[model samples]
Target chain A: MDVKEDLYHALLMEYASGCLDEGQSLIIAAHMALSPAARKTVAQYESVGGAILDDCCGKVAMTKDALARVLDKIDCGDSPSPCVQKSKSTMAYMNAPNCLQTYVESATWTDGKGGYQTISVRTSCHRSKARIYKIDPDTVFRVNTRSPHQLTLVLEGSFHDGRAVYRRGDLIVTNGDAVLHSDAEQGCICAVAQPSVFSVKRFVQQIFIRY
Target chain B: MYITATAVKSLAPRAPHSVNKPMESGRAQPKTANTNVNGAHHKSLLLRVASKKDREAFAELFEYFAPRIKSFLMKGGSAPDLADELAQETMIAVWQKAESFNPAKANASTWIFTIARNKRIDHLRRVRPEIDPADPLLVEDDAISAPERMGQQQETEAMAEAIKGLPAEQADLLYKSFFEDKTHADIAKETKLPLGTVKSRIRIALEKLRADQKVKELWT
Candidate 1:
């Protein structure tokens, strides 16, 4: 809460612009849930960026099939589980108390009720239109009928989202699914994060589709 | 190809409207694309640059980053022409020094950003030619202040209403601070006033920006 003003502003702009890395993004996202004021600041900055992007109507570059192109360029094939990387870094910083361990351990969680569980973290890492959301078990964590789906992947944990329980070695399909969800009790924790403005874009798309 | 001078350059290909057409396959695919070696790891882009012989990748990197560098330099007070020239130079440096790029040290954007910031500092020193880091003028005062001040004014319409309500000197400082990114020294230099006086005006300007009734009303 006592973050430097410069750091706050820098983080605000970075978070709003979807410029932060995954770790930073996750930190900010967690903060958004804890601090309404930070969330408001983020929303406010997003408004600023939205206005800028709007004014930039034709100024910002729009890659045709950019999502696809960037996706193809990435070599996700047989890549090591992201948790290994996370734990490795966490291990490097293991000097800290048990909190870091809990943080990584929380990457896989049980609902504590045995009813539902989260499986893995799914992220679409487009710089401006990035997102990281958790995939919960017993629930599809469905993108509403009018959501723009980006690249989805399992970052950590495992659970059955109405399909197979994708463990560490599983590669979830990036696209070609209209709807899906994890239904296993061994809850999954995947992220469905996206850029803040994509919701707005999706809203507009919804209106367009309805019209 | 004329390069199809469109209003905006599209970096990724978009799916065409017609069904018969298969989208051109090789540009880059977001989905099913090569899994990124670095997933937004701050230095992912720079790490990619570390390996030699990725010239096409380097150019793509340059194309996206150069304009941003130009904008950053210009915002920090370099002349437009100078910023543009330096931007090109920075890209060249990126190419020549790509081998030495270290992802462990800094990410691509940060590395490029540092290069630009350094270039601007170097340019400032050359243009001013006065060695005086001790000058209060060079101090960066844009350090994080209360977030409340940054709100509402983010919108130009709101800013316009707020600025209309500010005293002229205060308004001038606001413009100089945000628009020209002028330091206390530069503002003093421009207005022929003492650095202390410039700082006071900037504070007063911030007050008005902070207290804009329109912003207050919107927030409430």
Candidate 2:
């Protein structure tokens, strides 16, 4: 497999194994929403999970009343609330994939150094900080990596890095000491997940760059 | 997609005595037909729960999957009591979400497996973002024709067979990844194998499954 396909396959394997954190999962979900191929691959991986589960021979008996309790709940009309309903509003919400819409709705954007906007997303993994960046049209954004690992997924519009252009649903993975410089031809929105410590150094760099 | 009369007869909610027989018979027997037949039976039961609120059918499904789900959770290191509670929650979700189970897309085991997986995630207090299949922006698989779409059931059966055909070590790795929720690095650490070896083994297993005639015909 080529590098991109290999990376996505690895990510999907982690996803199917339930090893991915929330932010990384959101990236995969969003990509699947846009690409049928990713969804098909994820489905195949999940079928493998199902087959393994089905093949498990060990049977741990439940507590004596387990069935009775569950049946009682069903009779009592107890069910968790259905998946979050899609709300109506906002250009960004409209453009963002359904999986990312909830986060986009609650995100509070603040001004960044280079006329861009960013919001820190709440993710379950303590090791990583997830953020969404909105870049203005015709803007150039340069970021130096401090994180050992990072993932950036384009959600809307397109950005041209020195090597290639990333459009919606495309993912860019940067590892240790890489520099990311992109120019947005149109207003661009992207989600990023990286080590939490990277944010502090980036903040410091922003201050120095501003001065 | 062809449901023989015997399959339906085996699945229909029978008398209490007969319904209890399968529970007493122990685990499902390993056979190529067992997974597909059991899947069809469970699908019918789930659909009954959906259409008629059939408690008997639900009971049969509960008897079959709850113990397995409990075992699945325990393998992931959850305490027995916690696993029991989550298993109960998963069954309840199964009842509530029965209306959403589309036989065209997934069989009973695959559907319930997802519900259990999500329950485990929620128990860990982690969010798992899922793509809504109904989302307007979601791209549909137009490459598949109508006749090919009808092959999903056979594909699932073929998948189970392919998994069974895998080498013991490769199958063990898959069990670790799915049942134990271990990452490649975790498996590597535990097995004392290189991470690349673990990953490649998994990839090889998946590629083998994908190579099944039904699976390849349907998806690729």
Candidate 3:
């Protein structure tokens, strides 16, 4: 497989295995929403999980009253409520995929260097940080990666990373050495996740460059 | 959760492929003792629960799967008691959500596996965001023909068969990924294999599964 396909394959495997953190999981979930092929592959991988579970029959036994407890819970009407659907009005202005709607709705954007706005997305896993970035039309946004791996997913419009133009739902995975200079046309909104490595020099440069 | 060498070795002998012969001819072979029998039986039981709210069917499912689900949780390092609780919760979710189960989309084992996985995530104090299948922006598989859609019902069985036929090492890696909740990086660290090799092995395994499905489709 080519590099892009390879990365996507790896991501799908991790996602199917349920090993990805919340931020990374969101990205893959959104991508699957936009790509039927990815969805099919993920389903395949999950079937493998089911197969493994089936193979594991009788390894560890449950308590004898397990079924009785579950039936009691069901009879008592105490099961948790189903997931609440987002109201249409709340989803009205959201341009991101449904998987990301809640996060995007609650995020507050702050102005950043080079004519872009960003919001740090709250994530449970401390190993990585997630953020959403919005760039204006005809603007350039530069990000110097300090983490070993960074994943970017385009949510709206398009941006050229000097190699190819990435549109909505496209994912880009890069390593630390790559300096990304994204030029947006018609503006852009993207979600990014990387390890928790912040370069103080890069932050200082961005702050001073804005002045 | 840590998987000991002894645990993996004990599990390897009972891997499904060793028991089920690979499909050779589409029409000639009789159904043997394999997941297909159990899978189809469970699918019907779930459907009965969905259609009739049959407590008997639900009880049967609980008898079969609850133990497996508990074992699964324990393998992932949950305390035995916690695993038992989660397993009960997962079965309850299965009963409450039975109406939503679509055999065309996934079999009972696969469906319950997802529910169990979600419970495990909740137990870890983590979230697993997923696409809303009903999302307006979601891509539709409208191009798939009716026959292909019908073929999807068998896709899971094909996958199980495919996995059974995999090399032991690849199957072990997959078990680690799904059962132990190990990422490729973690598998590499544990197995002392390069990260790339782990990824590639998994990729190859998935490709083989897909290829097997395609071959089965041609026969259908």
Candidate 4:
């Protein structure tokens, strides 16, 4: 049994805190799926969230018709659709989580430059977006959504994030005003979720993995 | 108005003695016991919704949680209108998924607040685009049946007391992390502390929290 307790626990803490990078988040989330100890620890942090949420003690009134509207939505079957069941079952996304699938299936692929391609995932809630990307091995996938927060989750293959290697199921969340350039060690398929509108920039293919 | 006389009687021990009167339906007043959530009144209301498809019970739950949820979302910077939309969606989910509620696992507040948190996150990510990856408000199901959540039901008072006992520095860091939703990097930048120091401070606070004798027993 290979257990990276401290490493994964820290990751879980970041995840539970919602500060984890997309790549590392996917990794930790995947790791938690298989690691009970990590799951238990993350649960502790989540409970901490529960504690604070309880203490917030303020109330903002909802409109009188709010409940009626929700009931109306339910009556009309207008709630969020999970996805087309059959397409999801046959579609192979490897170890990707179900939440990832809902947005991934939203759009068709655009074009790729230098083995990197992207498709923006449409969401009904007008505030955010989900994008799916395909990156070939030995490439630096640079993104500049300029949005305050962006999450990258590796659906397949691996990448080197200038800190640690992010393999399949890894998530990396980056914030700030700087553009990011991360190198992939192998063919990587990822989904990027954000609220800002962005299209895939040009990809630079290079071999940098020290094997 | 949805709480029946029977429910008010049944939940007397769990709620403040004041709300037991039919005239004091709790519609205008939110319960003061923030810590002792999952009150029996709420559990009974949800149970009614689940078993009887009781709209009145659902209405009562909506009145209590919807506004609180809207405020919760706004604290994260959601617009009032958007927050209202998300809160509405959250209530609908509660109505649709009320059957899944298990009072033995979690209180009504923990469960309903979680739904609000998720809706807020989903809503923010759509509109704002650049949310912190480690946004501290990302909630998990807080039910007792959720493995580690089991013995925790009986420990909120103990946990609340223990939190007051934590070092001020540690508590401040926790406030920033949990209440303000600051990431370690963000906290470090704001406090001028090294990144490692910020993480360690948070880690220490968490360790102290989890190490509480009563809390430990609950988790175990």
Q: How many backbone clashes does candidate 4 have?
A: 30
Cα lDDT of model 1 by residue, A1-211, tens digit? 1112333344444444433444335545444433345555555444332221111111112234432333333323322112212231222222211211223432333332222232222333332232223344444443343322222334345645453456432323222233445534533433333333444234223321110
Off by over 4 Å in 3: A56-58, A80-93, A105-108, A138-143, A179-184, A197-211, B1-34, B213-220
By summed lDDT, the worst window of 10 consecutive residues in model 1 chain A runs over A51-60
Q: How much of the real interface does each model capture, measured as fnat?
A: 0.01, 0.59, 0.65, 0.22
Model 3: per-residue lDDT, tens digit, A1-211? 7655666787788888788878788778888888787787787677777766765323457788778877888889977545555443343227777777765544456777666777555555666557677767766555555554667888888877677888887888865344343444467778877544464234424422221
Ranking by TM-score: 3, 2, 4, 1
RMSD of 1: 24.1
Chain A TM-score, candidate 2?
0.73
How high is the lDDT of residue A202 in model 2? 70
Question: Once model 2 is optimally superposed onto the true structure by TM-score, how far is the C-alpha of residue B14 displaced, in angstroms?
Answer: 40
Candidate 3: residue pairs that collide: none
Off by over 4 Å in 2: A80-94, A105-109, A114-116, A135-148, A160-164, A176-184, A195-211, B1-29, B133-136, B140-144, B192-194
User: Candidate 2 lDDT, tens digit per residue, A74-113?
Assistant: 8899886565554533433457676667555454567777
What's the TM-score of each model vs. the native?
0.27, 0.81, 0.82, 0.57
Pick by DockQ: which candidate is best? Answer: 3
How much is B192 displaced in model 3, in angstroms? 2.3
DockQ, ranked from best to worst: 3, 2, 4, 1
Stretch of 10 with least lDDT, candidate 4 chain A: A202-211
Predicted model with the maximum TM-score: 3
lDDT of 2 by residue, B73-187 (tens): 8878899999999999999999998999877777777788889988888787767788877778886776656665576555556776676676656666677777777766677
**Per-residue C-alpha lDDT of model 1 across residues B1-220, encoded as one tens digit per residue:** 1122121114212212111222233212222112122224323444465665454565566555565555545545567666666666665556556677543322354445444543554454321111122322222223334443333233333433454455545544443443244544455676666554555554544445546665454333
